[model samples]
Target chain A: MGIGSDMYRQQILDHYKNPRNYGELEDADIEHVGENPMCGDTIKMFVRLDDDEETIEYVSFVGDGCAISQASASMLSNELQGRSLEAVRGMDRDDIIDMLGVELSPMRIKCAVLAEKVAQDGIKIHDGELDVEETTTE
Target chain B: MSQQAETLDVERIREEFPILEREFDGTQLVYLDNAATTQTPEPVVETITDYYRNYNANVHRGIHQLSQEASIAYEEAHDRVAEFIGADGREEVIFTKNTTESMNLVAYAWGLNELGPGDEVVLTEMEHHASLVTWQQIAKRTGAECKYIPITDEGRLDMEAAKELVTDDTEMVSVVHVSNTLGTINPVSELADIAHDHDAYITVDAAQSVPNRPVDVTEIDADFLAFSGHKMAGPTGIGVLYGKQHILEEMEPYLYGGDMILKVTFEDSKWNELPWKYEAGTPIICQGIALAAACDYLDDIGMERIERHEAELAAYAYERLTEEDDVEVYGPPADDRGGLVAFNLEGVHAHDLSSILNDSAVAIRAGDHCTQPLHDVLGTAASARASFYIYNTKDEIDRLVEAVHDARQLFA
Candidate 1:
């Protein structure tokens, strides 16, 4: 409505409008939920791991949240499919930020990264690397 | 409404807030999240510093002069808050952690005991989590049904639905005086009348209302009210819960031990007075004093003037935002709406829009704003909000419009 048409990229809105990999994973080996509380952005992430507990056979998410969070979740599910749990554990904040393809304020950085955090937490729980009680606020 | 009225000396007011002096993103810090929490003024900061520095003794327990001074300051803050909200007496105001805890106190102490099976607790869809979830928990515990009045397309409460929902089974009606997300100023007085007709007490969540407007508990005839100090330029970790004297006396204490007891012998203990009985453990003395200072500051500026100023600004923001072809605004398009705007760009996500605005040093809130039920009703998971306060200016609104235009461009 103002200047460049690049702001509302079709790819971004397309993923948001009709998100792929946007439902619950039945009998998930690991699951975790995180909420922003202030903004009311909630996310529940699910992970199905290989028998050896090294690779993520199937990853999915189901929750009601903002478009940014939903799209990010969709993107993460697609990226993390067939990827090993250890590879995602090695991923840093900068990697997730870069994947979003947009700048994020400190406050909103959480919204964009919330799904990743939950996914990592779920992975950690599955691998027995960390206890399920240890909640990460990433 | 004319814009020719003398503008508030925002520069002078800006100087009073130390946080405003800090630079952000190579620009002057422009904080638009007043609805979340206001920056503390120097006077209030100094009051807190002086209390912790000089009078650092536990109040109501020590006999030293420092303790006496601290106790007096704490009690004076209670009195100030009681007078600020036009309560019947100081005993009516009980200090809690914040508005959430204050409302929880009412729900656990009042709701758990008074409500039972077949009882109904009426609330509106526009309530914050603090107001909504507490009632939900109470309903779960007491087997009482939780009913909500739906919101209209313009984000106003549907009074027709409210009338239908409120019946003889309605035990209590807790509604927000002003919606934080939509900025719709609810008709609490009229709602109170409806609740009273059913012989039910009403509790008003004044978190958004008290900070922006003048609220008289007696005039509204609210049996209980909850608000936070931080929302009104006061310190965090402190809030006030105002309950009718008789109702408070009848309810059980929320917490146990410490100053809340009159006499204890390990067998049977008598609870203290109306306000003190509910306030257990060590109180937030310094924050309470700062809250009193904030009350004085608002009283000096005049709440009516602040409300009128915000109304004008809200109307101006609504008008300008609507001009953008892609912008979809939520809430009632009325001058009487509170000084907040929740909207969404055509294509960009609210978080992305908020992030881009941050790049331009234009602070705004983006999300469900802790009113998930209302957002669900509005058919969106999140929205970007630009809220106005005493320090905000029309020029800032212009900046916001331009920045939103920039955000739209970035995503386009």
Candidate 2:
């Protein structure tokens, strides 16, 4: 496969094969779930916040989906372990694509952003500022 | 393969579908997405364009000659389609937008009016969302309980489970005749018998079966049968919903407008006759004619031979796909399947597989196939499906195998 191919990039396959921070955290402070209704791909993100209440202490996730979705979740959870929740929630689609290290077709873009979304959703739920039902990101 | 060729002139059949001759990239297009929608042959296409060129007018409302001709053509479609499905008469066929609309018509028009809190509407897990979600919504509306007859490991409907599921509490049973995802052909006649024993009506979502197999509404003793026109070589925007005459008479109309009313007053309106009562407004005028043409085309080719041809294709495809390493195929045994195979290769997302296949000029469907619960049961988010049709060939199936091989080498 060509390196330039948006779908078969080395970084994507790497994360897909060896997804980091997979499984659930027992003492998680925030847990949120998100689903792609059209594809039936679901991801549940778990996060334990630091004493500061903003920085991520530890994070994990569990889900079954396409490489973009699974790999994107793995990479996102791993990246968030040392970052602040505000920094991640402030991230736009471009930031998530940058984290993915691969370009995505418009249709697959949601897969790349799903993890970022669930993390944000988790933070919102932790703060009691969001409705779990209303905020289940598509 | 040779035996299949003898029964169907594959080359001649391929020529009739204009899109079959086109090339994608450097490779000729090998379309196997027939379960989604079949490529319309030239005759059906011509029938549509011919209607627009010759008789362009609103049906039933106008008193002019154009309306008369359009009305005649549209009603002829009713006769041809009714005969094709073995309905009692032309009055049994009501034209709708697609099979989804037909299902909704039954749910809103019949289920809402007839069902109640204690009623149980039996369904199968193998149903597409068009069949499942409608009943689910109806259940929510009428306070009925929606029960499903789960599929066996081989993906066929569990008849043993079905026997237990359709009991006295069951009020109506809606099931898919041929599963779009699993490729299982359900025995509707048997299911209908069980439902009737409980004083329940059965509705068959024949979206996948009607175009590929021989369907007889009379033989199946169906209360309602629904199938889309586009899946059977006809134009889009038209579908057929066949209900037994008396049952349709009992149910109310779905949409209200121009042609469906017998008499209209400022206060209220009286509905029209049997099939017309169900069809409101100026329907898919040209599409109805084209669907009739499609029915005629399938008839001339002989449906039994078509069934044999597709069964052979499914068997061949299942074998070829299974031969590849890292691939997992889902569905019943070859003989029991209708005309498709759903599969996914290890380490490759079904969508990724679809994109990879597209590079080699092959077309296949990749998604949940609108059966999310089944996908949940299969423990996958989605799967790839390659469904066969009359014009598809063995070489094309080989191309599909090669594409999967490429995907395995790259992704797996």
Candidate 3:
């Protein structure tokens, strides 16, 4: 049986149908792209750093995937709009699924967290803390 | 219902497969992913169990009783596979790990030796990555150019394009006998004829064809054919690569080990006969024996009956899928295709539809079906496929239709 009807709540459906902060970003401080090759879900996250360079000034995402991936990216974009770069690294798969108010199957875990991966990757690249080879994957 | 039961006997056939009796989430499992791999029958399972329990010995190595028994059984497996597909003889069949390995065995052993720079290798866009990627690697290694035969919008092979593609420079023309993604049954016999006209050898990836339909290597006139055992009510890790005896005799051995060598020393070694030269090491002994049992099981049921049953189910699924306004079906009409229906619902991703379908205990395959080129051609990222088998019933189709409605309600 399915996990629960709670997974497909109207709010989650709303985010998927009318995604928030959707589209590419120009003059972005950090841009990261990620994909779950298994299902061909491609997600890109762009973060514009505020003048202080500690907090996220604006966040935008672009992706083509299942509802869970798209909705998670949409909902997460709103959460990261003004958060610090520190909070982005602290976020994991559970936090994303928890925010969605649903449980994701193991096979779909990659989809729900692809946006968060891109955001954190963007943070690492922005700080110049990540190796170029490492940033190329995950 | 009772009248139609006489023709299919699905209930009786279901009993042969123990997995069909299983339940998921308090509901009977409706397995619609037969095209990926068919569930093994009790007889095939028992045959494998008997092999290990009774005669568990490495074939062609020992002169002991267990070795003799294992060798006999394994040889019988080759004989059964040969007869199953109307191969010239037992020597034509070579056991490999799976269909992928079978395809690679030809690419490495045959294609690498024959194809070179300035040569063209013709393939269909509808090939699974197993068949397509190997040719790509061959092209890279041999400096051969790989060309594709275009598929029509409706998923049928465009013969006109194929005529242009398979020119005199083409040395090998490889194609899938049946497309795993779009369910289109290709005209391989005619393709083989075209390849022969160009003086090129043809290889048929029959992994999707031999299971549900009657396939004869002789009738198709294929120089090489490959199919997996798991897809035909047998075990995994057991596959067959059938080549014309003369072609196999001339090709270099793909692997080197004890069983494949007639005489080995520090200086040099001579290879064994036609089939054994390709099968290195101990090989999949038990799975091969069970594969013979699977062939026997299919023979008892009759390939013609299975083909008819699958065609009917495919037609029904197509009819039901087309009735929904939001569903855009893929592949040719049921009469022209095999026993599978692939489609996409409006605003529903294939994975999402499959996740929801699982709630109803209906199993299906979602995603590109390993034909990324075909998926790109179809303008769909992924599609949901429901493939039928001998054990599938109309009741399962009804449940699948209901599951689609539920998916549409949730997503669309």
Question: Evaluated on chain B only, what are the TM-scores of all the candidate structures, in order?
Answer: 0.97, 0.98, 0.98
Candidate 3 global CA lDDT score: 0.88
iRMS of each prediction: 7.1, 3.9, 2.3
Q: What pairs collide in candidate 1?
A: A5-B412, A6-B411, A6-B412, A7-B410, A7-B411, A7-B412, A8-B411, A8-B412
Once fitted onto the true fold, the runs of candidate 2 whose alpha carbons sit more than 4 angstroms away are: A1-5, A21-30, A37-40, A46-62, A77-85, A98-103, A132-135, B1-6
RMSD, each candidate, Å? 5.3, 2.8, 2.2
The better candidate by TM-score, 2 or 3, is 3
Per-residue lDDT tens digits for candidate 3, residues A31-81, read 888876556677888888899888898888898888888898899999998
1 or 3, greater by lDDT: 3
**Colliding residue pairs in candidate 2:** none
Residue B97, candidate 1: Cα error in Å is 1.1
User: How many steric clashes between backbone atoms does each model show?
Assistant: 8, 0, 0
Say which docking band candidate 1 falls in: incorrect
Per-prediction DockQ scores?
0.20, 0.38, 0.51
Q: For candidate 3, write residues B64-182 as lDDT tens digits.
A: 99999999999888998999999977899999989999999999998899989999999998999998999999999999999999988888899999999999999999999988888
Model 3 segments more than 4 A misplaced: A4-6, A129-138, B1-6
